[model samples]
Target: MESETYRGYNVWGHAILQQEAILAPERFAASGTITRNNKLVEASGVLGLFNAEAEAEQAGLAWALAWIDSHG
Candidate 1:
């Protein structure tokens, strides 16, 4: 996870991984979490999934910024 400060909020990029079966495969996804004043304000939700970490981080940041604009 990487944290970025944006407009007084700390936005974190989170990677989500799920293993369907021991011999199957693992799936990857990502989302954003937001904190303000050291307290959690928002969690991982509404953010779209991506096949790559970079794409997910980019999308998560965009989503977080939009959320802040509307809800801040």
Candidate 2:
């Protein structure tokens, strides 16, 4: 239900999840830039600067699915 790495915008890294596709595939190394959703929540830090479009989309969907499985 998940992978080790993901891509988004211009970044890539480990993908974390919450519940119900709330938070997108966000990879951040900083301590700021927070993100949230109805069920998923997290932050898109510096890691986002090295992700690919497909990786990000895949991670995003994966994150959402994980969220649904966990919180749904």
Candidate with the greatest lDDT versus the true structure: 1
Candidate 2: tens digits of C-alpha lDDT, residues 1-72: 122322221212243332335566544222112123322244333333223445544554444444434543
Candidate 2 accuracy as TM-score: 0.32
Which portions of model 1 miss their true places by more than 4 Å? 19-26
RMSD of each: 2.2, 14.1
Worst 10 residues of 2 by lDDT: 3-12
Q: Which regions in candidate 2 have their CA more than 4 angstroms from the true location? A: 1-50
lDDT of 1 by residue, 1-72 (tens): 667899999988776664569985554576888899999998867466566667677777777777888986
Clashes of each: 0, 18
Instruction: Go through the candidates in order and give each one's C-alpha lDDT.
Output: 0.75, 0.35
TM-score per prediction, in order, is 0.73, 0.32
